[model samples]
Target: MAVAVAVAALTLVPLAYVLVSVVAVGPAEAARLLWRPRVGELLRNTVGLTVAGCVASAVIGTGAAWLVERTTLPGRRLWTMLMAAPLAVPAFVNSYGWVSVTSAVEGFAGAVLITTLSYFPLVYLPVAAVLRGMDPAFEDMSRALGNGPWRTFFRVVLPQLRPAVLGGTMLVGLHLLAEFGALQSLRFPTFTTAIYDQFESTFNGPAATMLAGVLVLSCLLLLVAELRFVGRARVARVGAGVARAAVPHPLGSALPVTVLGMAALAVLALGVPLGSLAYWLVVGSSTAFPLGMLAAATATSIGLGAAGAVATCVLAVPVAWLSLRRPGLVSRVLERSTYIAGSLPGVVVALSLVTLSIAYLPTVYQTTALLVAAYAVLFMPRAMVSLRSALAQVPPEFDDTARVLGARPAGVLWRVTLPLVVRGLGAGAALVFLAVVTELTATLLLAPIGTTTLATEFWSNTYGLAYGAAAPYALLMIVISAPAAYLLTRESRRTVPGR
Candidate 1:
């Protein structure tokens, strides 16, 4: 418990840095910067994009999950994988694909389109899993009560899906709030992009810090909203009856339409970016792939990702254990505190670390260790969520069994609980690793001066208007994220929390 609290504090370094920096600037300076017309525009854009993106994602994700899970869409299994598989594609890569094909996706519409396509999987996977495991008894009862499918769905199905819906929506909001790469590429000036622009153009000036403080405030607002919407609702079953399987809804005359819709969505979300990468890979005129530099960047990204994955999983253990084993105010606070830093853009986290390190730990500034720490902090929630799911699956009987066999608590954890949750640990670690590898803002700001990563290299090449040169790195990122995303989909089917 103490360990979890300490880790939570460590994860909050970004928030602490922002608070201290903003306070040091004095209210007059903050008002001068954040109270301006430009600040208001940024806020409007940020809030608008977040709300619109979440709505679109909720609709698309929930719709896709329902179709795949409830309807007799042919090859629903394959379609299910296709729908969720977009998780592997980074939003920036999706933007690069669309822009490479056509420049029409600019400003608000483009930002929402690309983000919804990229992040809807955040909603889809969980909802689909819940739909898969959902008990049919309730729906049957609704039918017996003479409620039509539509009415039953709206009143019964949707209400029961609240936990998954709200959880997924919260993820969408957070991703949109923290999103940098996609928004930047799409030319939407959210708080995150503005903060990055300020830091890049001004080099850690007070203006950048002030902008970041506002972004942090935005993140805090998001956390508060999530807490209210996703309160501690009980979703567990009270009885021991085996759950009946859901009856698949027949498509009938809608079969061709269902197939077309599913095909179009899959092609748009998964096919376009992959097709774009392949096109740039083989046919571009400026195709001067830097094999050696690509290799070096890949090596750096993998090293940092692997290290960050381990560190994040280690930090998540106590928090997840306490949340599951000793559920209470402290555990929930420790668990929830990790979400704030994660929702701020990587630039905010990176700049916060940059300020903290330069002010008090200059020697560690720009070090690989510092970069990994930032990754762990930013993605700790991913690890903790997966860890808690894994922990929940490890029944108490195993612990009791081991203890009765004269095993110590530590022995029970290692010998029994660990074995049961090894898959979940892998799931959590893989998620953190993939997130770290694709991570841009923190790595860009906190990495060692000479270090280059796939994300950074891709950004550099693209920044220089060399799309062909950046293709390999983008392709490599998708390749790495593919299995991790698949692992996550598999893990989502486990003994997840209620609904």
Candidate 2:
């Protein structure tokens, strides 16, 4: 419980900083900053992109999952890998790919397309997992009552899928809110980009923090809306028998079209960025691989990713344990608090840490420890979500049995509890590692002197319009992330007795 509280308090630092900083800016000054036409335009752009991106991702992800898991789409396993492959490419890198190919993809439309391609996997993975485990009994019952396929899906399967869909879309929305690199590359102006501009271009801490406060409010609204939609309704399986695998729905005459659609999705999501990177490598004027720099960046990114993943997952364990084991208002609040920092833009979190560190703990300022803490604060929710799900699946009776057999709490956790949720630990660690590897804005602000990760290296070159030089870093990020993406695909797969 104490550990959970400490973790929650650490995660709350950025939010606390934003609020305190905003208050320090007089209300009248804050109002003046927020009420202008520019602020309104940014709000509109941010909200528009976030809404469009989340909806498009949900549709694409959910549809693809249905094809892979519920329908007789050929090469289900291959398609699963292809669908999840986009995740290996960071959103900024995706935007860079498109922008490099043609100037056409440069505004709202492009932003939506790039982000949707990058983040839809968040939806697809969970939804696919649910579909794999979903009992076909309900669908069969609905069919026996003479309901049509679409109708049955809408009424029965879709409702059961509500939780996954909502969770996926909510994550999409938050990512969109905090998205900076992709949006900036596409030349879109949103709160995140605006805040970055305020900080970097103007060095106006008060103004930047004020903008952060608004962004935080937007995140809160999103969370509230998701909770409201989720409500108290139980989406879990009600009665227990041997849960059987859902039969694949036949596409019949639509097979070609379905196959073509999935192919297009794969090409758009994976092909374009990868191909663009290849193109730059082969033909771009500035293309050159400095193996020394490349090796150093790759090693740094891997090391930082490993460190951040381990730290984030370690912090997540206590919070998830308390939430599942205790289940009360305090535990709920602590768990939820960990999520708040995640919704803040990486720049906001980074800047807050910079301020807090410089003022109170100058000794740790700009240290790798500070950067890892920032990673933990920014990505804690990823670890928490996985851990909570994993922890929930393990019955407390096992812990009781272990305790009864003379195992102490520490022994029980080490021997019994941790072993049971080891898969979750791996999943959570992979997720945090992925985020840490791709993180840019926070890395830009928080990385210690002389440290260069792939994300930062890529961003520096791209920011300078050296697409060719950036390609190696981008490609390396994709390569490093591939195994983790494959792991995610495997995690989403639940074994059915046969095919």
lDDT value for model 1: 0.80
What is candidate 2's lDDT per residue for 13-32, written digit by digit as tens?
99999999888899899998
lDDT string, candidate 1, 354-422, tens digits: 778898899888788888889988988677656654575345655777889999977876787777777
Q: What is the lDDT of residue 14 in candidate 2?
A: 95
Worst 10 residues of 2 by lDDT: 231-240
Task: Pick the lDDT winner.
Answer: 2
Clashing pairs in 2: none
Model 2 compared with the native: what TM-score?
0.94
The alpha-carbon deviation from the true structure for residue 236 of candidate 2, after best TM-score superposition, in angstroms, is 5.5
